[model samples]
Target: MNKLPPEALEHVANYFRTLSEPTRLRVLNVLGTSELSVGEIAQLVDSSVANVSRHLAQMAQHGLVARESRGNSVYYRVADPTVNELCDLVCGSVARRFDQVVSAHAAFVASTAPARRRRAG
Candidate 1:
């Protein structure tokens, strides 16, 4: 099999590293829907303003998101629509896995539940 060039591998690794944090993933998820200010993002993600700002800055540095300053607030958006696509891919996979688990659990519960007799009204 052909291996990725070292530089390409490094770039891919860096991108994955940026998304390795749950907070960063949450930030990306929020930004995927609409642009939001740091304060709004922090509140939505249950993170501190300082921490959100730091994460946004790191994401911007990696070209994962773009920021625009309006008045005193900085609003961030996904740098590329492809990033949103990647987010969707990850989220879809997770949702499918969760659905499978829930279905399996439901089947097990149904089998284990006591049968009930029908009563005439």
Candidate 2:
């Protein structure tokens, strides 16, 4: 891969920052491959319409989402398809780490069980 210049790196960082919010990620997940109005997205994400709108606007500005006006409502969809791929990669990594942690904890508990039984007896 080619190295990015300092300014380009900053832009990349800002783009990642845009996706760093839980609400925005939820909005993307809610959107998936379908275009939905702000109200519909808000209901699906269990957030206030106003709050979802704000997040949608921010995502739109970042070029992460696209919006269209239909009658009185603005509908949104994911603009950068690669965003979903990126999220999937991160989610897989997180799941692996979580499993590793759980396994380690279970092993620790198993190891301590015998000692505890011995002490009690």
Candidate 3:
């Protein structure tokens, strides 16, 4: 990224920005698993067909997803498989942080339990 020119860096930023939306993330998650029609994606994402189609169009433009037309239906899939890798890395980091928080919370409760019991007794 430091090696890239300003214009290329801006494009990279836009690519990440494209994935920042919750709905777009959900759409990509579904595509990572299987190719689906816009309707199918809409159903799984708990959104409307029109809304999902709009998201797909933008994602396709960004080269984040691929679209295929079959008769009256169109299907979408993740164009860059590396996106799953990126998601896995991020999710793993978040999961580790959550585990740390959970462990801390459990330890705090254990430390306070004896104090609470003594007060009651």
Candidate 4:
């Protein structure tokens, strides 16, 4: 892949920074493909309405989410579909890493088991 310009790299960094917050990630997961009001998102994430609203505002500003008003309430949905793909990629990588660690630990324990038995006897 070609190297990105400094300004482009900065924008990329900013976008990642926007998704860095755990609450925002939870908000995105709860949102999925559904457009939900602040209260709905708050309920799903088990957070206060005010807190959810603030996070939504920040996400909206970053173009990570879009807002629409329907009668009395504003509903939000993911504006960048690629964000889901990005999250999935990271999650898969993490899961694979965890599996490797577990497998390695099991192998280590198995390898040492016979040595321990030999020493005991």
TM-score of each: 0.77, 0.95, 0.90, 0.90
lDDT of 3 by residue, 44-74 (tens): 9999999999998888989999989999999
Stretches off by above 4 angstroms in model 2 are: none
Q: In candidate 3, residue 113 scores what lDDT?
A: 100
Once fitted onto the true fold, the runs of candidate 4 whose alpha carbons sit more than 4 angstroms away are 117-121
lDDT of 4 by residue, 1-121 (tens): 1699988888888888989999999999999988899999999999999999999998898899999999999999999999999999999999999999999999999999999999999
What TM-score would candidate 3 get against the native?
Answer: 0.90
Span of 10 residues, lowest total lDDT, candidate 2? 1-10
| Candidate 4 residue pairs in clash (backbone atoms < 3 Å) | none
- Candidate 3 regions exceeding 4 Å error are none
lDDT of 1 by residue, 1-121 (tens): 1698999988888998998889999998887759999999999999999999999998899999999999988999989788878878988999999999999999987876654322321
lDDT over C-alpha atoms for residue 82 of model 1: 88
Question: What alpha-carbon RMSD in Å does predicted model 2 have with respect to the real structure?
Answer: 1.1
Choose the strongest candidate by TM-score: 2
lDDT of 4 at 63: 92
Task: Give residue 46's error in model 3 in angstroms.
Answer: 1.3
- Candidate no. 1 TM-score: 0.77
lDDT of 4 at 73: 96
- Mark the 10 consecutive residues where model 4 has the least summed lDDT: 1-10
